[model samples]
Target: MPVAVGPYGQAQPSCFDRVKMGFMMGFAVGMAAGAMFGTFSCLRIGMRGRELMGGVGKTMMQSGGTFGTFMAIGMGIRC
Candidate 1:
């Protein structure tokens, strides 16, 4: 186990542990939330019978790209 000592046993995680944990947690949470919202938004768009690309698709694509870019930037900042 990669443990660090402090007031809290988990106060500091090793560099490798931080990277691994960050990736795992971020991926898991992101996927779950993204999937749920994506599904909900798709269904909502369908119900409206709007041109998806003109209406919701563009927003969705932009949001996805932004999310990815921000995550990449955040990881870089962490190091």
Candidate 2:
């Protein structure tokens, strides 16, 4: 009688797999950083609940402005 082997295989990742992995890693890192900074800023400002939410909103608005400027610059460069 022949012994059966456990299922095991290795394969190289394709470009699509690489892109998927990269996106997942980036999303996880961004979430972690956002949580840390949001909490820290709120604590530093002595905010709670609604106040913390407001602080987050303000930060998001500021981030939007910065992101917009950078995106515009990148677009200009590409054009």
- Give the winner by lDDT: 2
14-77 in candidate 2: lDDT tens per residue? 5455555554555455455555677788989799989898777666555545544454454445
- Pairs of residues at least 3 apart in sequence or in different chains that clash in candidate 1: none
Please give, for residues 57-76, the per-residue lDDT of candidate 1 as tens digits: 55445555556555655665
Candidate lDDT values, in order:
0.58, 0.59
Give the clashing residue pairs of candidate 2, or none.
none
lDDT of 2 at 49: 89
The C-alpha RMSD of each candidate to the native structure, in angstroms, is 6.6, 11.3
Measured against the true structure, the TM-scores of the candidates, in listed sequence, are: 0.43, 0.48
Error of 2 at 2 (Å): 69
The prediction achieving the highest TM-score against the true structure is 2
